[model samples]
Structures are given as structure tokens and as C-alpha cells.
Target: MTTDPPPEPNREPTPGRLHRARTAFRRWRRTRPFWAAVWTGLGGFVIFFLPMAPLGKILQVGLGGIAGMAGGVLLMAMALLILLLPGQRHTAGVIAVIAGVASFPLSNLGGLFVGMVLSVLGGSMAFAWLPEKPARRRRPRRTTPSAETPVSLGSGSA
Candidate 1:
């Protein structure tokens, strides 16, 4: 089979296309401000539900309510910093990670310790390799029949 070469790239917008596109975008950003606001509000509402979340759970775990607000704000600032560098990375995901790491010492130390020990033990026990069970010699069955099994079928088939 023959392979085909790649096609050439066409990189020009014709005439007033770019201008119209920019104008349309600007018009959208301005005219749809209500939708933008609603979306922003919805996003915040969703963020509020993050598990072991940076903004809420972090604040609650890290400090009391008044300080919780401050903690939440700081968490958001950290998220914004994580978000600054690029194409479609989630600061919240990173924040969740940090929160997971940081919250370790604050609560459930006993549970954590137990879980770690159990996990390690489980892994080691799982893979340390037990010897195969000693192969049992096949025992010759007794000719005597039990009452439950049909004696004719089991013992005296003609």
C-alpha cells in the first residue's frame, strides 16, 4: 500500500471575516453579561460541593468559621496560582490534592495509621508468596455408602 503525504495548511480568514468574528464575540461578551453572571454563580455553587474541598472543607478543617472564610480565600488564591500556567489544567484538582495531603495530620491520624499499616501488610502478604498448599494425596474412598446418596446409582450400578 502507498502512503499519502500530509495536506497543506490554509491559514487565512477572508476579507471582513476576522473583524465580524471579533465584533460578534465582543457583542456576546457584553450582551450576555447576565448569562455570564449566572454561569459564574453556578460554578461557585459547584465548587462548594467539592469533596475534601479546598474552599469549604479545607477551611473547616484548618480553622473555625471566621477564619474559615480567610482560609477559603487563601485556598482560592493558591488555586488561582496553580491555574495561571496554561491549557486546561484544573487548579481545583491540585487544590484537592494539597487538601488531601495537608488534612492528613489534622484528623483521623489513628485511622490513617491503621489504614497505612493494613495496606502495607495486605500488599506484602498478598505478594510475599505463600508456598502452595501441600498437595494432598488422593484418598481412596471407602466402599461403604452414605444413606443420603442414592445407593443404587453410587454403589451398585448394573
Candidate 2:
């Protein structure tokens, strides 16, 4: 009979590249105001795009084209700032809120109110976001009764 080769040692499977990347991204996102930035950026896009869109004609009023463009750009910049400098999120959030409110009168009714609301909400979220504190390990509790406490015997009566 032929001799069998020795069995290989057991080893845990390594994570795939995509899985590693996703995990890293989740960790990064947890430490930052990710959703806030996304909302602000989306709002800015709407405000900026509406002015140049054909539907803009229906919503055009005042000096919206130029002013709206400027406001939208400013809001987008604030979103980037919030992401890049989490510590300065308050300032960026305030700026974004202001820009969003201004867009209403200047850019297609703040992209038909959708962009304005989104920008405001994003700014609010950014302003409220706080870093999470590391969790502390707790000591295991004793299951046995301590000498300091007396144990009851048959409900204190026979």
C-alpha cells in the first residue's frame, strides 16, 4: 500500500481584499460625519444643477442663476470642510446652513425646497456629531455570596 502524506496544519482563512477594504471603510466612517457630508454634497449638487437645467425656466425668479451658483458652491465646500476637519464641523455646519437658506431665494426655490431641506438637515447632523469614547472592560461579578452578607437558612424558620 502507498503511504499517505502528512495532513496539513489547520489555518484560518484570510479575509479577501474587498472584505478588508469594506471593513476599513466602515471604521473610517464611524469616526467621521459621513452621512452629513453626503447630504450636504447632494444638496449642493441639486442647487447647482437646477439653474442650468431646462426645468429651471419654470422656477426662475430674481437674480437666481449667478447667486444660486455661488451659494451652491459654498455649501459644497462646507461639506468637504466638515469631512476633512471634524473638529471644525460646527463652523462648517453653520456655513452650510446659511448657504442652504440663501439658496432658496437664489436657486430655483432652493432646488424646489428639496436641496434646502437636505442641506439644513446635513448641517444639523454635522453640528451634532460627536466622537465615540472607547469602551471600558468591566470586571466579572462574583457569583458566590460574600462573608459580609449572611445567608438565609430555610426562610429563617423551620
Candidate 3:
């Protein structure tokens, strides 16, 4: 009886679920203002948490704890809005900028200026983000024989 060789293992490994998930996440992030959302969220956290911390005794310069809290919450909401509705990024960015500015007088110096800077940067980034254009397929070039070239035959020349 003739023995056949075992089937060779696949040279290219198939992607696992984790890889697929990561790829999906990357695609989603690229389509939206991901970094902007991250920055705004962090800024909001800072603005919201600073006023409640012990450092509040030294950094508190706003109208009151309540105003700071409100401003922070508003900024955080704007960040979420930007992420959820990228088409409305302009509006959300403007709102976030206003909130960041307001936080200066409402929150503790806009969370010691850190939160305000982050919020402004995030808002601007969100406003500036644009979708990538789809790539166009190029047609293959066709070459024609040139008249200047002489055609060769199997017969030897004298």
C-alpha cells in the first residue's frame, strides 16, 4: 500500500477572538475622536475630584463646591456626547470649551489649570478630527511595442 504524506499545517495562523476584538476596536477608534474623548474624560475627572479632595482647602477658588461639580459634570457629559455622536463634534467641542472656561470661575482654577488645558485640547482635537478618505484602486498600465525596436527571427543574419 502506498503511504501518503500527512497534510501540512497551515503556514498562516488564523487570528483568534482577541485579535479580532482588538482589530474591531482599532477600526472604531479610528472612525471617532478617541483621544479627544479620553482627554476630556480625564479633565472632567480632575475637575470633579479635586474640589472634593483635602487639597480643596488650598485650591478652592470657585463660587462653591456645587458649581465646580456642575461644571465638571457638564464637561464629562460633553466628552461622552462627542464619542457617541461624532457628527455633532463641533457642537460638543464648543460646549466643552465653554464648560472648561467656566470651570475656572466655577471650579478650583479649572482644577489648577490642568483640567482646563486638557479640556480645551480635547475639544479642539475633536473639532478638528476628520474622516479618512477611502483609497482608490489604480489601473494597471499597458505597454505597447515600440516601432523603434527591430523584431528578431530564428534565422541567423549573414
Candidate 4:
């Protein structure tokens, strides 16, 4: 049997799909370091416990693999958050960057700590920056002409 040739690397991705993909990719990449670090770190964590993880050998093995992937997702997720969150997005994004850097240590503990710190920072910034809406003013009550009139038409009193 003849082997099929591999697709060309230079073939351009379609603009529509490419644009969508680029958008998604940029989102993923922008948050890459965070997701990668987290996923990789978590993956390492799960992989290390594969033998004793009680989910059965299959699951344990699965988790080991998953843990490895967790680091990847962690980075992607971080990039994704930067894309998703607005306003203080740039500042919020640094957490992902730090986490991505920490991923080299291959430790989830580091990510957990960083995540906690970022969460507090995110909350505080949101609390401090959100503009409060002004209260609506109530209109003044109107006096009707009838109420001011002392004369009754039928009684002829003025």
C-alpha cells in the first residue's frame, strides 16, 4: 500500500477559519504561560501519585497523563482570562505570566499561591475601580388647576 503524503506546512489557513483560529490561538497564547504552567504543574502532581491514586490503575494512569496536560491548560486558561477580563486586564494578566514562569519549577503549590494572590488583587481592583451610578432624582409634584380653584361652576360661588 502506498503511503499518503503529509499536508504541506506552508498551505495557508483560510481567512475565516484562520481568523477565528488566530483569535482563539491568540487568546490561548496570550494566556499560554499561565495555562501551561498550571496544567504542567498539576499534571506532574497527578502523575507522581499514579501508583497510589485509588481511582483504579486505568484512572490513575489517566490522571497521570491528565496531570501533565493540566500544566498546558493552566497556561492556556491564564491567557484566556487575560483575553476575557476587561479594563484592568493588563494587570490581571501578569499573574498568568508569573505562573507561567513558575511552571518551570513543575509545582502546583506555586500556582495555587499565585492564584490566591491574583484572586485578591482581582477582587480589590474591581471593588476600587467600578464607577457607582448616581441616584435618580424624583420630579417635583404638580399642583392641579382644579385643586387651586375655590369656585364651583354649578353652585356659582367664586
Best model per TM-score: 2
lDDT of 3 by residue, 1-158 (tens): 99999999879888999999999999999889989988888888889888885656535554657777787898899899989899999999988888888888777789999998989888888889897878889989898779998877778977
Instruction: List model 2 lDDT by residue over 1-158, tens digit each.
Output: 99999999999999999999999999998888999999998898888878774655635654787777778888889889988889999999998998999888777789899989999999999999999889999999879988999887766555
Ranking by TM-score: 2, 3, 4, 1
Error of 2 at 86 (Å): 0.6
Off-target runs (Cα >4 Å) in candidate 3 are 1-12, 53-62, 139-158
Error of model 2, residue 40, in angstroms: 0.5
- Once fitted onto the true fold, the runs of candidate 4 whose alpha carbons sit more than 4 angstroms away are 1-68, 107-158
lDDT of 1 by residue, 1-94 (tens): 9989998798785759889898987654443222322322222222222223455656566643333233234334433432332221243334
Worst 10 residues of 3 by lDDT: 53-62
- What's each prediction's clash count? 0, 0, 0, 14
Candidate 2 residues lying further than 4 Å off, grouped into runs, are 1-11, 53-62, 139-158
Point to the candidate with the largest lDDT.
2
Off by over 4 Å in 1: 1-63, 87-96, 100-158
Of 1 and 2, the candidate ahead on TM-score is 2
Give candidates' CA RMSD values in order. 22.4, 7.3, 8.8, 16.2
Better of 2 and 4 by TM-score: 2
- Which is the better candidate, 1 or 3, if ranked by lDDT? 3
In model 1, the clashing pairs are none
Models ranked on lDDT: 2, 3, 4, 1
